[model samples]
Target: MSQGGTSIPDEEWERFLREAEAGSAGAPQEPSARARMVTRRLREQPGPPEGWRTYRPARRRRGKGWYVLGLAAAVALLVVALVPGLLVGWFGGGDGADAPRAAGETQRPDGPPAQEAAGRLPTPDRPFSGSPAAGWADGTAGIHLPAARATGWMSRSEVEQALDRTRDFLAASSLDRAVLRGERPSGAMALIDPHQSDVHEFIEKAFRAPDRENDPLLLFSRFRPSDVRPAGDVVRTRGRISFREGERDAVEVSTDVTYVYPVVRAEAGSEEVVRTVVRREVVLSWNDPAKDRVEPGTFSLVSYKVDATNGGCDNTYTGYFTPVFGAERAATGAGDGAVVDPYDRSTPIGERMREAGDAGGGTATRS
Candidate 1:
């Protein structure tokens, strides 16, 4: 090839080829004077023809500000990745973390929020005076039985006797219309075991009504002992008397009394009486006197609970009577107008009864 657009004559090219052939033929062929002259002439390579200039790559140096910005961006990305995990570990509960928490500081997965949990309130020990189920309307009207004073340690027989006396009094007085009519039975108050504040209050509330003239039949209608028939006698089921060193002696007597009564209901303007068998569970507690010698008449009633009712009788209306006029005689009419359904707790009679003046003995209209 012609070098860089320089032309080579045919004679010179031929001479060069002859020299190259001579060199390859195993002859010691050093360059001859003519070949040297010809090579020197070919070595003069031509440059670019008119105005082309050589190009040089430019060098760029970055400033400190660019390096600083790159470094800051890297640091910011690292912080963004790690900050949430650090926050969770610091303030909120972290995985496998066992940190101490303040008292009452609870965390429930499905319960109320943290503020509500921290500010939760406590429940009352005793919301009302009587049974918890009775709510504010517990018939006792906020009255609680007084604690009974104990006599000395009473024998089981003595406890049974006291309970028997209590049962007999309850059975006899519970049915007497005279007792139901706001008239205390003779000596009935004595049988009440004066220490029983609950019994005393219960008796007091049972026999009186808000208005004697207008609601004359209210007290009687609510409680007519005429319906009660003792199955046999008060039967003692459980008796326990405890005497321990360094402790006050206590007697607990439980008895089951069965009463048969007719639960009367007015149906279709007529009267339907259904006899019910009610099992009353009477539990009594007596404490021994703190002194060495037993005090006479110191035995007192502590607690009494009526158990489940097995039979059905609306005998609640035995006291509720209508006035009947006759030519020669006057008789009490049927209890059709009596609102003595013991199960009818919604009746306004209980409120009215509480409004009645404090009576010595009264029965609950809605047992």
Candidate 2:
């Protein structure tokens, strides 16, 4: 909310509005001097995370000082806008009463204070600042690997190699821009052991012709490019990865990485950034050719589970991620365990595999 450590008062926000309105006639939409100062301060700060470095949402562009005003709105914990309505379609109205709840946010009242107040629009420079993902790592950085140790079946060096490959597979499946924009997840699928043709071909066929039962989302996240685009290039992430010895001289690695994607409707002049979260859980079996008759240096996909929060329930038929926009959906009865908080990183996806991360707890409050 504070831009480069400076706080913005509510009344001062109103003053910007008045000044902008008065200057509207025969005036330019250029940023004010104060906004320019904020821009300089931001440039002095660190750059955004590096994961998929070349992804730009086809036609989106930014104006000067929007990041300053956007961060100001966020830090204030009030609705966004320095010059209210001057930057149209960016955030909820100034007053707390005008705050709009995001379409499929699932945090309970007991959750974080920022989430308690709804409609916190992200700035291009700091997309995760107003959400639970604020504290999460950007892109592949969140997928941390454990120290390699001998685990009966695999040697220490081999275990390390396996871990490295697993991380690559994860990066390809979740953070790859090509995979996200509805392309075949070849980068990820290629890691699958070719001998395990059943699982490999199943994924290939699913992508070729997808449906409810054969969803590629089972292994990767894909959204229709025509419907929505990532708000900023960054994708916030947090979760755990674990490994254990498996049957048939294989090592089983289980990973639970939750991805928070800030997105907006794919239309010109649209700027309200909403988030869609997807939690992907996968079990990878790294088979040893010496004993299992498997291909060398590859893993077989054992199983996978994917759950999406804020991805529209109605959009499931298309087998693409189409998150709800504008308004909330009516409550529903069908769900797993509890309402799965896509933001809750504390929940474990698999049985205790040596305490991968966060303390265990209840999942999100489902509708």
Candidate 3:
């Protein structure tokens, strides 16, 4: 019905029905009631003015919608890729969760102090335990062998300084002038406390040879510092020197050390001929620091020979030196004497020619 409604005749309605049927029969089936209703409403709307109502085709849009969709997809993919990495960082990785505790800690379920754990070493930053009185006794027995002769061991600092001096002495026949005065005499005196006093003294005195003695050329000079360091109190210092004799080289060496407290002293002498080493003797004693004397005890020295040229040998000597004997020997300058510089002319007529001609054994003569 038009906006200006007017009743239509029955004949006009019949004619309209006939035309709709003809249109349906000529093409597809007729529209349903609802579709027809929608079509009539659209047709009834007022048309554009004048001839402009004729016709106009629709145009497709080319806006940013497609680009926006592509951006959304890329952002989704990036999120998927980074999520796992972010989670791992927030929580610890596999390694952190499974790692074992560091060595030095107490392994018991009720963990004790970290320093006491098995196989763990206290860091350098930590302080050493209580007094060093018996500290050296437990950890470094090999350093002071033969309990009877074990006394004064060297302090770490003392050993280090002595080694430094040795290097300087070797370079120039003098101690580092900046550190000490005068020429570095060819003798080494690394003295520790009473604990190992006898050992130190014995070593200092034992490593000497008269110029007329069998072997003249003292070839090698070296110090081997071991890791089995004294905890405290007792200390150790080792020096090795080689003397050339015969076709083979006879090495005279000693590790002079002392054990403090119940003070013990030792001098371990070793001789190497060819490729074999013979532990010549080990001197030991109990020391009385107050009196600056070795107590009333017996010290001993053993001699052994090894023939490495044919493989090895087993010839060992066993003996002991009593306190009385040691005292007598010391008096004669055989047990504890002023460090002798073989190179020193004052060493006596017999020993003068045995002196090292120069700091470096680079030059040699039969004096």
Candidate maximizing TM-score: 2
lDDT tens readout by residue for model 3, 1-367: 3336887778876776566445444432211000000011112322111100000000000000000000000001111112222211111111111112122111111311222224322121211221111122211221221111111332334233323322222222111111112211233221112233332333333334212111111111111112011112211111121111111111111222111111112233311111101111111111222323322211111111100011110111001011111233224222111222211112221122123122111111000
Cα lDDT over the full model 2: 0.51
Pairs that clash in candidate 2: 1-74, 1-75, 339-366
User: Clash totals for all models, in order?
Assistant: 23, 3, 30
What TM-score does prediction 3 earn?
Answer: 0.16
Q: Rank the candidates by TM-score, best first.
A: 2, 1, 3
Cα lDDT tens digits for candidate 1, 1-367: 3889999998977877665444445422221000000001111322101110000010000000000000000001111112222211111111110111112211111321122223222112211111112111111111112223333365445544444444334433333334433355543355434544443453454334322112212111123334332211111111112222122554544333222222333223323222221222333444445432332333343322221111212222122221111221112222222222222223122232233223211221211
Ranking by lDDT: 2, 1, 3
- Residue-level lDDT of model 2, residues 1-367, one tens digit each, is 3679999898977776666456545422321000011122223433111100000111100011101001100001111112322111112112111122222222212342244345555655455645667655555555656677886477887777787678777777777776677777666766766665455555666677665435566567778889988776566666657788776656777777777777778887677666766666677777656565555556766555454555544223455666655543224423222223445545433321112212212123320
Show model 2 residue runs off by greater than 4 Å: 1-119, 123-125, 328-340, 349-367
User: Would you estimate the TM-scores of all the predictions?
Assistant: 0.30, 0.61, 0.16
Cα RMSD for candidate 2?
Answer: 18.8
TM-score between candidate 1 and the true structure: 0.30
Cα RMSD of all models vs. native, in order, equals 53.6, 18.8, 51.4
For model 3, state the Cα shift of residue 124 in Å: 36
Q: What is the lDDT of residue 76 in candidate 1?
A: 10
